[model samples]
Target: MGAHGAPRGRAARPAGEDSRGAAPAGRDGYFDLLRAVALVRVVAYHTFGWAWAGLVFPSMGVMFGLAGTLMARSLRRPALTVIRGRLRRLLPPFWLWGFFVVTAMLLHGWMPDWRIVYWIVPLGDPPGSAWAGQAWEIVWYLRTYLWFVLLSPALLRLFRRAPLPVLALSLVPVAVLTSVPPPEGRFGGALTDLATFLFCWLLGFAHHDGVLGRLRPLAVVLPSLAALALGGWYALTHQARYGGTYDLDDNPLGQAFWSAGFVTLLMYAKEYAGAVGPVRSRLVTVFNARAVTVYLWHELALILAVPLTDRFWEVPAFERYLPLESQWFLFGVGWVLIAGFVLACGWVEDVAARRKPALLPGGRAARMGT
Candidate 1:
């Protein structure tokens, strides 16, 4: 039995842990479930622009932290080997989606730029069809994740020797970015984002290495609360800077502190959070397997929702029963499209990961069987 007597079925596991190294015992609870929630929250934030998503969960930081923790585990192998495995799992789905989006751009009358070959693997922000611009924005996560993974070996070594000092020093880059936001066109802005989020990424290393996780609850909680308070004060004081919202994205210093606080709290609380039943386990499996696919295609569904809703509202039967103005109608329209894409394209993740392809993680029948 897993934590809390859960089955710890295969469904509870995330991909990328296959055969490489067995996860430490008792590691199943929060990682997969939190990652799955973070993925959904990110998708929701993009689709709906919900302010509460960041305040409630800070999904992007959670994702980076999760990636960091997993990367820390992978680093047990040679650095080059770890990088190769991450890129191997990450790039295939990216390439598949990139090709489709690029082709769609061409059909939409976008001019062919030979430079778009960069979109094939997207080392940096590779240009694609203007129509697909929002779709490509999410690639920044992949780009930054790639950089963090590549740098982990060196970063991890520093952390192991002087963890507190190294973590404190990581905040300096975010300080610079917060004081002066980076310029728009060059790599400065991407570098700034990476710097701002780097603290949370490092916190993940602390979690994995027993630096933070072994501490007494109050020890972790007090520092986390202090960081949160500091960030909250900054957000409140600088409301005018972000157009009167507390969004961490527009406020770099705020993000640095807020994400660090959030990361520590979640990792520290791993002792209790989990999903234990067959039903929940299967959901986690599907979510974990389809996570990359869902992230890649959600923006496309969002873009298509506008036109699809406009067309659907024209039908009197649909319009009368489900008013176009209703939130339910909007969510329904968006999710139905997302689900369609998931069924159609979710297998791309499996293919990219070199697993046997299935429409969803385990297919409908397998889910039912579980």
Candidate 2:
């Protein structure tokens, strides 16, 4: 659903420790793996438009949770320093991506107004040509993320003061919003999204602070399952009201509770941090490194893949060999483009992090080591 910023310095403490009784000292692969999977699911859901995908893996909530955990870790330093660092890491990649998108929109006859500044800071939804609307719609995630980063210092303090009660109360906003008639404009939409995922974001805070670690397994599991069931039940019962689909994105109250329960279990099981093997670790690294590039360009890739796939039909040999009409083929082609974007644009992330740019993250180091 969105790209997550990685935390620098030490990882969060796991629920359990090894014989040495120390936490992992570098990037947390379990969190990385969750983020990578969430990114993939976002691409897949967009390409396939599957409603049940939200239930299976609430990608947006998962991403916000990962970002929240990392934000909490980074906030151990001065709040201003952490926030500036996050924005520095986040914005350049966005600006670079926006350059092309905005240029294309302008070429397509989009007349700009004062609101075009949203393309820079994205505190609100940025405008785009209707033809490329899908690409711009994803900016809402970044907008929400920016707001979270800016607000985390205060949110973290509140959570630390009363972790359980604050966590429980985080769901109230979405419930209240959903109980009323849905809001009508961009601000309303943003509010709904923020309230829907605020609990998961706080769950990340809870994870980083080791709040969930102190809970009894049953205490965590029972409530989480109950919430999950309630979310599913609400979606099922309210389908007709929400375009006759069970997609969690269509139901804020359902998404809030569903993602809360789902992400809570994930953060609660931090022991699996060590379960990731070497090959998977490298893959996770790349995903985390290029998350912004991949996320920003993925919709464009999917959109372009359609026309490209249609072109393949003109070549008899290509038509014979490729399943050009299948959605799977489009999915595969979309990833191929995503990989290309990662290779082309991912180095911006390295530069933003103040590291040397490489085709792949750590490519230079790996070569030097060899």
Candidate 3:
């Protein structure tokens, strides 16, 4: 459920989506398209259990790369300032979401743990409770992002001084995490997940530094393909190792290499820029404008739709066909509910960002954030 393809740690979209604005003359439409597609893919995959989609696009990789690139750009401003601004933008809507979730769970008879205070303002993966586990799981992305953003000043400096070595060092975590089982503990596992994607995050730094764009396309492309191939081979053989599942998420080492390659290719920076039509433009605007709200609330909609759809299944005509259980039908329900949630809560993102509010922030209004 994490919107994986952008600067999503503090904000939902990449730095491209950092501002509420129009094309601004030089912005690429495809990044917006990439973020939009990644957001949809994360929600759809979570809803439909689409493992192939993760392999196909690797939304988290795309997101880390996007975030890393943007963080690099933001480094021009003071690091402390950048972190503060990001937190200010991120926390308000998140606090609102947390309040609703916690209140609901409390109403359902959850005894509050004093530890529950962490979830109220989570900096690491918020500990999930028995009552609303699925919703709490999404916090992993934000929590990991929090640490990465906090470390960026140093990480970026290390990367700048010794680009190749720093990147190679990043992959070391991938190897350690992948080859061995993480000791059973919250801190250990969180670090492992952070390591799983660390290389790609650094690769994002390389992209921002022009390391990727300067290379021959074949230099990046060929190695990335080879790494992906190796990842596939490793996963193919390890089917016996995991619970007979082919999910790459379970294979931390393989995913790190694969995502590093993927991010490298995506951030090659020299890739040609493109544009889309008015309708597509509006869609991108809406997606970026409400990205954080949508990412947070879409899964809630999916969870609620599960019980709601159960009622629909009781209809005699639809019972036979199981239309209510159809993947497409569930996706449609989630999408519509998400739209309504966006209409209701998206203004929080705007108000938090100090951007003007609109039911659909598009066209000239989208550009107003400059």
TM-score for all models, in order of appearance: 0.86, 0.90, 0.86
Residue ranges of candidate 3 with Cα displaced over 4 Å: 1-26, 269-280, 314-322, 365-370
lDDT for each residue of candidate 3 in 12-127, tens digit (9 for 90 to 100)? 33322322132234434556667788899889888888656767878877777777766777677788888987777777888888888888888888776556766655665565
Against the hidden true structure, what lDDT does model 1 obtain? 0.73
- What are the lDDT scores of the predictions, listed in order? 0.73, 0.82, 0.72
**Backbone clash numbers for all candidates listed:** 0, 0, 4
**154-223: candidate 1 lDDT, tens digit per residue:** 9999888887789878889988777776777638867987897898889878766656533455667798
lDDT by residue for model 2 (77-165), tens? 79999888988888999999999899889898898788789999888888777887988889999999998988999999998888899
Clashing pairs in 1: none
Pairs clashing in candidate 2?
none
lDDT of 2: 0.82
Q: 112, model 1: CA deviation in Å? A: 5.5
Top candidate by TM-score: 2
List residue ranges in candidate 2 displaced over 4 A.
1-24, 271-280, 363-370
